[model samples]
Target: MIIRHFSSLFIAVLVISVGCEKTDRDRFNPLDPLNTTTGGRPQGLQAVAGHERVLLSWADLAIDAVTSYRLRRQDNGGNETIVDLAERPLSATFIDSTVVNGQTYTYRLSVLIQESEGGVIQESPASVPVEVTPGPNICWIADEGLTQILTMTSDIRAVDRQITSIFGAKHLAVDPRNGAAWTTTQFGGADGAVAVRFSSKGVIDRTVTGFTFPASVVVDPRDGAIWIADIGATVGEESSVSRFNQNGGLLFKITGFSEPSGLAVNPNTGACWVADRGNNTLHLIGDDGTILLNINGPGQPTAVSVDPTTGDAWGINVATQQVFKIRSDGTISLSVSGFIQPVRLACSALDGSCWVVDAGGGQVIRLRASTPDGYHIGQQSDFHLSLTDFFVPVDVSIDQISGQVWIVDRGDGSVVKIAANGSIIRRFVGLALPVALTVDAGPR
Candidate 1:
């Protein structure tokens, strides 16, 4: 009987010991690295703005535990995209290039961890949201007849900010230093002719008077001085070239031009080149209103332009259907003929080539700096743009930012925008007269 009692005690001890072992195994924590739970959320999430991109960065929670990271981005329009970055946990940096300018974006970051046995993923909570806005690309155009300046997108969409109260606004020049625009007006009466300055936001910053008929205006990019081609009351009564400070104070006036139509400043040398239609000559004037050189043209020179890259000046003769290229030293390098009453000319600062408007031919011609025929004088045009739908194309301007050409057709009162590939992008109509048009790269 004693032996049977001892055996029962041993069996009871074995049962108790086995129960305690099972309890310990059931209390194991699943949050351990060998299990399924992940590390803490990523910290220090950041989104930096760029031209058309956003850079994302974050701090890693546990480098050894994390197998990868996930990034989430959302735009202002509520569009969301999730990206999985495998095997990139430490020093995590990502660039989102599929973004547009002038847009805002939000971002979030999280880390992924794997279980030691099953390789299952467990993601931590995302970091706090970050936001950024990219820089926008825009352009501006001036309408002389309507006395308004229109701001446009890269694709020709008009913005809400239209500059008004500019009376008889003729030609416009945008300062490269600041995006400010300068123009000449003939609207104020006998003393109405003035040079006006407009800020980038379409506000009139200042106005300088004492001009009889301010036909053309330009700003010296080097010193920010204002230059005006003041065509006097009578044909040769008071015609002069005037210079003014950034404020409305007159610096000096050089009189001699009998009908100055257009003017351009040499960015390299700071010299002002004017086209005098009355004398059929192109005059190169120094910054102090002193005549430096006189270049005689084939006929009446109506418009002038200077290539900033090479400091070469180009002028168009309306009476002789010719284009004159003057070197930086005031010597005539080459004079090409074949145009039909070219009214205006402009040279690309980025490239040495030029564009001229032909009113008689109803077309625009593009000329290269060097001719393939090896002749420096009187070479044929590289290409001619004759849009069948356009008539009486008088003035032309190029947007350096977009590399697009804009033409003012006086016959239809329309503005035609052409792409760099010679494709007609859009034709803006409903304008009255539209005698002159100038473009400004509104903001970067």
Candidate 2:
């Protein structure tokens, strides 16, 4: 009887022990790495902006006895950046503070199943990349440049310059920040050479050289790189684009231009619109020098302009005395005719106005455009902007800000600054056989 009683006691002990083991298995720690697949994975990760902060949130995230969750971001190069939070399979959010204007950032959503002692729980494969770009108020100058010159490209000038260089200098571009003026010597340039930087006082601050027959020059606002088109092939050689830092340090030289004459760089698109006069065409080059499209025309096209707002290209043909409206698909159309060697041009983003310089007849013309290349003064898009006749208007430029016009008259050796309606606002006489004219909006 005593032996039977001892066996019964042992059986009871075994039963209790087995029950305890089952309980432990059923309640596994949710945070344990093996427990990560407890209820599947996180879903619907979205990025939301909250007053300078980015909030990364997810839905239906499963958690049990976990310590924390880990979040990460993925860059365009496929690198991972992180954000972390504590505890629970519950849905969660992460607030990101490292965001600013003019910057593009990408992120990936992930869940971290926290480990017991140290180190983080294993993260799920990065969620599809989510992006949020913060916006800031930008002080952008309305590029009402040569359009005003085109409207009045021909009129009342001795040296009839193109609108962009309507004054006495080959106004290359305007410093986007402070609107300082830049230009080059037109007649004989060896390379990516910058002849002068006109201060607010109209004084030369710097001169840059060391390029190959530079034609059009532009400064990048993002990295502030100076890009100049080298027309070396014009004299029987290959052509290229010379890139330099803002301070004049040479960066790189890009080849494959055929008599490239004019260029306009869109800061927004990072695309360069180059006028390849060799084939009477316009080549839209990427920021990295890739040609997006090659738009051809009926004549030798020289001047190029880009509408940053609409992403359109305007090719004004000097040889054919016509303007070609170029679509992004490499399509071209004759927007207007009867241009007398329209050498330079500009467009106003403000009122959709346009200007052109006719060096052939010493005239400055204007066309009020509703769209980038779609403009008409009455039925004729080509209207003589000048009330008086020009002897030789070589180049042209216009001031959209002040509604003033600046022109270089080669015949009179003078630079004329006029009001919007062809009235002489101010005249600079005896400034050489003035070759070009551009408005310096910075100078009051």
Candidate 3:
């Protein structure tokens, strides 16, 4: 009888131990008001303000214990509201389109978890509030010497945000449709010829490799496709132009070029104009990888730009110090000389005018199109800046909304904003080798 009593006691102890073990079915009590929170708060909460909208995103929760999220938004006037998210599997990003532009908003996020079989809930602590202001215009600047990308305010008086750690960031292009930016890294890192895409919130969205030496990149304003010019490993060896989707997927790659240094996409038709410096040729390639027109004899055309107002493409031959306007039908309508080392040209959509940056001349010259190919150079009313204003001006872009020319002076390490009437609006100084600048004035 004593032995039977001992066995009963041992069985009772085993049952108690098994009951004490935690099981997967055990729910966390998130509603406990004793300040002991179970689930952790959302991390890396970032808010990007846009035109009448704000995008909020956070890192994924480390565990699968979260059942829902509670996002709280507060405006500048102390008005608070909880965003209604009804999806079961919550997304990491939320776009609040009900926001108004120019108004500041603050946001906080928390996690909610089921704590019991009866649907009792527990809430994680709210994240720190993030504040942002929406604006219509922003400028993206790429500094190769500093290896950084900077976003400047609409007025060009202050920097809105800066993203560092980019290696050999030579050039950048912004997509006005989504506010994302794409750039090519020319040096350093294991992946030397790499291209990176940054999201609207300044986060690395995607990185595409396998380029030999990407010289320039541009976005198709019509369809948001990305075009890259890989100058190849060596001159006249494996040079190519590739097209990528907005998500960084390779759509198509057009090969057989000799150092395609400059790429310009036709804003209306999504076609690409490839300037091959090594072969001294200008190629007009269709979006479907077909060579529509190949014109030889532009004297090493290194840079090209298209005017959306007219389908004509303008190219600059650095070796010849000349600019050529190529008509849409594969014919050179006009070839103008007398430029002192014209490195880049940007055609304005506002008036079909082209702004040329002459590094040797140290001037930004504006040329208005009279015909399809001709810019009236001998005309007395041409807009020309004095050479004293710029030193080694490498790139030029136009603000379509305001028709102001933005010039990147690499030697002076500054970006100059000039009004259409030949007045300096703002001179953004103290940059480290600013190589490229693109203006984003919302959607056209």
Candidate 4:
């Protein structure tokens, strides 16, 4: 009986000892406390503004303890969204590309801490809210009739702003590097004609002086340098191409051209191709004022354009009614005749196609690359259209992305947008003798 009672007491002691061991383990466990305790909040939260997005960054306080991060965002209208950073737990930066331009946004950050082996999750406090507002996508248009530069949305819905002080604003080009539009004044003093760089808000930032007759302006695609074609006061004397930095400071000038009319720069090669009517030659110039190739033959080359895809240059001769293609190696590859006084040309960067403006015919011609087995080397006319509303189209610009063509009708004082299929999209009227037109690759 005593042995049985001792065995029962030993079993009872064993049971109590095991229970006490379990209780101690639960009370002193390091991982148990971590599962219940939250980590430190994220610090140094910041928001950087972008065209249509906001970039957020933060300093992780308990990076070693955090298993994931949570990003919270709220707009000015009080809409909220929570984003989990499970895939990039340690990433300190996040780009909120879903944001809209011109809208204010607030952001906060927090961290999720979990004990090893999948313990309870604890969330730290959110960081202080950071606010940011993005810049809107805008288009700049030069109006010769109104003698002003108009800022409008990409959809051409409304005129956001206008700079009315600019007189004789014949041609304009946008410098994407600084959101400033450079325009040429046809009439100026003895020193030379003036080109004014105006901000998107219609503020004149700087005036570039000393151009004899600034007829055309283009921005270098490789760099943001400005190139102006100065048609000299005389027939062939002093006609030159001038290069200017983004600040309107003259970089250098290239002389000895008879009459530099149209200008285009190849983004890949940084070569400026000028159509000089005085000498009836296509001058391919380097960034450092080096004449890489001067091909003489196209009768009175009026306008020149560089194909972004193939680096091929195209020039239209209004006198000969012919279009010539210059290869990247500075050789005349092909020439197509039978156009009615093609004055201006714009080539697409997305494709090797081009658009030609025929002032004599009052029409625009669309040219595209021939098929694999076709005879033409560079391009051939796909179709030609004479818009019923156009009287005399002077200049043409193409939106490479959307394949939209913008034509400046000088005779009727209108700017018309046409789709790639020769369909008229929209026409903006009520301008006074619109001479030049350009399209910006807004907010890429």
TM-score of each: 0.65, 0.54, 0.68, 0.65
What's the TM for model 2? 0.54
lDDT of 3 at 195: 89
As for model 4, its CA RMSD to the true structure in angstroms is 18.5
Give the per-residue lDDT digits (tens) of candidate 2, residues 1-444.
999999999999999999977654543543233343443335566775322456676664445434455677654566667766763445477778776532446776556554465765566555556665432211111112222122111222122222334222344565655545555543323433344454433345666775445567776656666677877786676798766666667767777778778877776777778787887777777776576887665478788776555666666776757766665566764377655567777665555455676777677776555433443423453443543466667666555454555666677655665566657744545444445444434322
Question: Residue 183 in candidate 4 has what lDDT?
Answer: 86
**Candidate 1, clashing residue pairs?**
188-192
Output the TM-score of candidate 4.
Answer: 0.65
Error of 3 at 272 (Å): 0.4
lDDT of each: 0.72, 0.57, 0.79, 0.73
Q: Alpha-carbon error at 8 in model 2, in Å? A: 99
Q: In model 1, which regions exceed 4 Å deviation?
A: 1-99, 102-139, 189-191, 233-236, 372-389
Ten-residue region with minimum lDDT total, candidate 3: 30-39
Residues 136-185 of candidate 3: C-alpha lDDT, one tens digit per residue: 77778898888789887655555668898887777789887888989897
User: lDDT for model 3, on a 0 to 1 scale?
Assistant: 0.79
The CA root-mean-square deviation of candidate 2, after full C-alpha superposition on the true structure, stands at 24.2
lDDT of 1 by residue, 1-444 (tens): 899999999999999999877654442332233222332446678776554766677764544657778888898999999988884435578888988876777888877777574777898777778877654433455666667765544444333357776677767777766767787777755556777777866788887877777888888878788788888846445899888876667888888778888798987777899889988888888887778988775478889999878888888877767788878777777777766678888887656667788787777777776733223222433433445456888787776666677787888867787765568877767766666666654456
After superposition, the stretches of candidate 2 with alpha carbons farther than 4 Å from their true spots are 1-171, 179-181, 185-208, 221-223, 371-387, 421-424
The CA lDDT at 95 in model 2 is 74
Off by over 4 Å in 3: 1-135, 235-237, 371-388
Residue 213 CA displacement from its true place in model 3, Å: 0.8
For model 4, which pairs clash? 145-432
Residue 229 CA displacement from its true place in model 3, Å: 0.8
